[model samples]
Target: MRGKRDIERELIHAEAKIESLQTLLESAQTDRQELKSQVTKLQDALVAARAPEAYRDQQIAKEEENRTPRDQAQIDKNRLIQKTTEGYMHALERPMDVDDLDALLARSSMHDIKGPPSLHGNDES
Candidate 1:
């Protein structure tokens, strides 16, 4: 009889242990799910934080690339304009000497020979 009682008590103890183990498994699963959620949230936050900075960096690089050619073209245009202005101003500032004027007239006379000058009053210089 005592042996039978001992056997029954052992069976009960085994059943209690099984229940405790099941509870522990459920708690562990809940903890694992919570940890997974936390990790996902952290990943999303990190991406969101970095996205704008990455985009801004890319935009800045593109702007710098685009600016180089435009700035160079502007500089070239300014140089060309400055050179043209200087040439025009130099021409206006200097009077041509008679020798230089004669040279110019002789060069022009060659082209003028192709067309007759109108004789209306035109012994016209």
Candidate 2:
């Protein structure tokens, strides 16, 4: 019963509606992907923020475990040297006076003359 022109008009309208829906679907899909990306980033940030001190310590211990024994010994030696240097710096806060320098030299001379104690308790040289 519908005329040809009426059917053509209806078909054109239907096609337009289908195209609009397709565009909306595409937009929704794009938005969904963006939201998923944002959620992943947020999850990563949350994990980083909530990381415990124990976790960090475990990571450090794991790294130390991976180091060679020689490397660990070298690190220990360096730390000891640094500690000794810091102790010396803390103890000698002020510059030594002439009398202090003289005393230090006297002590050194005494030690040199005494030559270190005899290991076998015999002074025979």
Give lDDT per model, in order. 0.66, 0.66
lDDT agreement of model 1 with the native: 0.66
Position 47, candidate 1: lDDT: 59
Model 2 clash pairs are none
lDDT of 2 at 115: 36
Give per-residue CA lDDT, model 2, range 2-119, as digits (tens): 7988999999999999999999999999999999999987865665578865556456666767976666678877556655555456547878665554444354423244333353
Expressed as tens digits, the lDDT of each residue in 18-110 for candidate 1 is 999999999999999999999987875775578965655556555666764666777677556655554545655778664543444444423
Return the TM-score for candidate 1, rounded to 2 decimals.
0.40
Error of 1 at 73 (Å): 45
Q: After superposition, how far is residue 46 of candidate 2 from its true place, in Å?
A: 0.6
Tell me the TM-score of model 2. 0.41
In terms of lDDT, model 2 sits at 0.66
